[model samples]
Target chain A: MNDLGWIDAALTAARPQAVSALLRYFRDLDTAEEAFQEACLRALKTWPQNGPPRDPAAWLIMVGRNAALDEARRKKKQTELPEDDVLSDLDDAESALAERLDGAHYRDDILRLLFICCHPDLPAVQQIALALRIVSGLSVKEIARAFLVSESAMEQRITRAKRRVAAADVPFEAPGAPERAERLGAVAAMIYLLFNEGYSASGGSVQVRVPLCEEAIRLARLLLRLFPAEPEIMGLAALLLLQHARAKARLDGEGNIVLLEDQDRGLWDRELIAEGLALLEKALRHQRPGPYQVQAAIAGVHAHAAQPEDTDWAEIEQLYGALERHQPSPVVTLNRAVAVSKVRGPAAALAMIEPLAQPLAGYFHYFGVKGWLLKELGRADEARTAFDRAIALANTPAEAEQIRQHLDRLKEGAQRKSGRGSAHPAQS
Target chain B: MLYAILCYHDEAEVGSWPKEKDDAVLAKRALVTDKLAAKGRLGPVVRLMPTTAATTVRAGREPLVIDGPFAETKEQLLGFYIVDCASLAEAIEAAKGMVKDGGGAMEIRPLRLFRPGTTAGALAAESVAP
Candidate 1:
């Protein structure tokens, strides 16, 4: 194979195992990261000429481990360096390492690595930054661009996080069963953050950060594999799959924000939806409801609908209620209010969200949803007020436009309802 | 080749250790060191003073020049051991026995080694640490 193809294949195949092994070898985040980069450079130079290896991950890990060891030895000036052939023979060495690193090893290294990056000690922003940097192989520049922050700032943030990990002296071992269960919640939250970071990509002509989304989904799947019996993990994976199923329909020809109601159902990825729904059904069958499962059930309700109007808003509202009990937050309540408006009339949703005005004041989505509910209730003044707040807090032009459309519709509805005495003229 | 298992203990616990127990604690550590020596694992082991005798320096800005360790931490670095181990896993396993029940925590960290040559060689290696 050509160099590019070979490099891509090697990276794709070896990434999980190599990273896992490096985490095992170095224990320090920065050292492990540096070691991996060294191994990759060697692979690029040698792999194309030698063709692909049998066990790419193992090959990369072995080469990287030896390289790290070699560098360490050279640092101490302790002994002569090993021969090149030994370092380059990754294909043979990887199989040996793979045998040694089976089930427990996989958990201790890769999954635990995920858990470490999302350690509760690190701030959420730092958690996402560290995960993107260490796990996804994204450079600080790439992560900075994705975050729309300065490269130097992002670099400093990542460095500070690594130092925290080092200073905190977080365990390098795979935590025991009790510890794993406790920390799993934090890990799942981090993965979802990764997905949302990509899912909620701000303005500009670019599409979503497909890799981040894909990697988050991939991590979720890996987590499911580890905890096949855990309903929440299953629900989380299902939720992402279902949400991503609509990726194609999420944008129009002009790359604008297509509301859930406006999206073309036909364009949705049925394969993803089916897989998502199946996983959701399996999770629900466990009869052990949790936040992720409830949210997944809500998504499942939407996925089952043939048209937007066919949505089971009553069930969705119920699922949202269960979700609130499991993991209540202002955001969940705001979303549930939308379902409330669809099922119990706009007045009910308006009542549901009225108490949330204080906490959700600065949140754009809160006002946007509130505006829609008020507009539905024929309360044009309050609806416009909410819409204005939403527009003011809008993160992008697209979000602003979506809120503006609601305000326009509200004014038009008022004008039609009040006949010729309407104070405000509706504008297109 | 050299790994450090830095022991972090509660300062209150260390403060309460009776003066009569000092030599006994040292004797216990000496026993542990002797056992490690038999297995060719011992390198350097030292018991540090309480966190009161520690200093911290940040990379930038006028150093806060704190009198004590980083913070009013319940866990303070009590002691450390440098062990020669083949791998990180080995080092961690070796460090596990260093802590007594409800006494302290040990942090096993591998020392970094930067070489004059091919240090750059490892830079782009893509060795992922999980």
Candidate 2:
């Protein structure tokens, strides 16, 4: 079919691969993106009647590079071109890029994956913004609108992000075979970070940037296609899909954070959940439990629960224990405590987190969980104090508001038992 | 008349859609396919992977091998449906039913040549209610 829609889809699917390859060639984000555009223009003029090339990305990459070079040569005709040595510092970088890109298993080009993943320190939000703008080939205005920022402000933000990427040391040495695992890990983390940035639990609709989440999922799928057998890659893809399945249900009409138990399960996307569950099953079958697998297993547990009351808290606690073993952060332990409270009692979970106070002192989720545990124990005054801290530390107004609602409920409960001074007696 | 309805759409736009949206589109299309299948008129329906995975072997001086789809055109030949319809009007109606949501191209052409193909469905189900 020579339909424009078909052509558009072909160009869109090939964009990241084509542009990323061009970026590696040109060593400039703007130049690569511009070249990709020029190449698309040519493809439009020729592809319809001619039928699609065997590989769209390889086609676009070859065409874009030539078009960019032709334009560059024309523009610099009067001026001297870059000395071949300057642009072709290929002795080390060529091998390194090849090693990394090859590990991703691209069929057409060996050194054509992504430059953005190599720039590691762009901060979460900026990393995502840069990826969307450069590698994803989204317009500055479109990115700004996605992030709910002004167009010019977004333009400056992207420029700054690009400058930071430009400043980072270009990698040279090809990583060893063992380092291939680490290489894929970095790229996977980058994609997950992008998803989390788009999946902020608060600030309502304003904070939930749909494009970022979608883009991250897309990247994860691309990564999975390369290393389909690698359990962790499957888990990474599954985790993003599983988490994103509930994107619409995670926030309320007011944009307040809705905990899993309270979320409208009907709002969840069954298709994504099914895909995620299938991938997670495949990952578990590999029996190579890693951090991503552990986390995805946790999400799988949530998705598998038909109702909040049906959740297997014991299984969840075990998964959290597994996660803590893999990652071993106080945050994981804090998450574990939620399950602990459900399986055992509030006192046991409270004891579990008591030592974590020093480590999770300023974290919002920590206090929120602690406050809920305290309220369950009928330690109303302490619960109120913890909630106050949670509100103060919350990431967004919606989060703060959620804690405020909790505090209000606590006050209402205390008022109902007016004369009971500071506590409640045991049921026994 | 036996017809091959070729499906085509912009890859980028479809790829960008959230998983839930993609599922909804499939769910709607199932409504159309069920009726066709019930009548024993539906054939194999397939959704091709991204064009990157495609390999085209151009039969030339030495049968040249290329990297992507055979025809790098605007929209892609994403998938196809085979239907046994009484007339072109019936086939067009089937094409329209398949794309009820209305964003892709479905080119319906009468098959000049024929072969027995593997059936994806048993085609023994009762009527698919509207």
Q: Which of the numbered candidates is closest to the native, going by highest lDDT? A: 2
Off by over 4 Å in 2: A1-7, A44-54, A80-115, A167-176, A201-205, A415-428, B1-13, B18-130
* TM-score of the A-chain for all models: 0.87, 0.86
Q: What's the lDDT for residue A120 in model 1?
A: 68
Candidate 1 chain A weakest ten by summed lDDT: A419-428
Per-residue lDDT, model 1, residue A404, is 75
- Give the fraction of reference interface contacts each candidate recovers: 0.00, 0.12
Query: Best DockQ goes to which candidate?
Result: 2
lDDT tens digits, residue span A193-249, model 1: 888777766544344666667677766775765566677888898888888878888
DockQ of 2: 0.12
Supply the TM-score for candidate 1.
Answer: 0.69
Residue A160 in model 2: lDDT: 88
Chain B TM-scores of the candidates: 0.69, 0.85
The candidate that wins on TM-score is 2
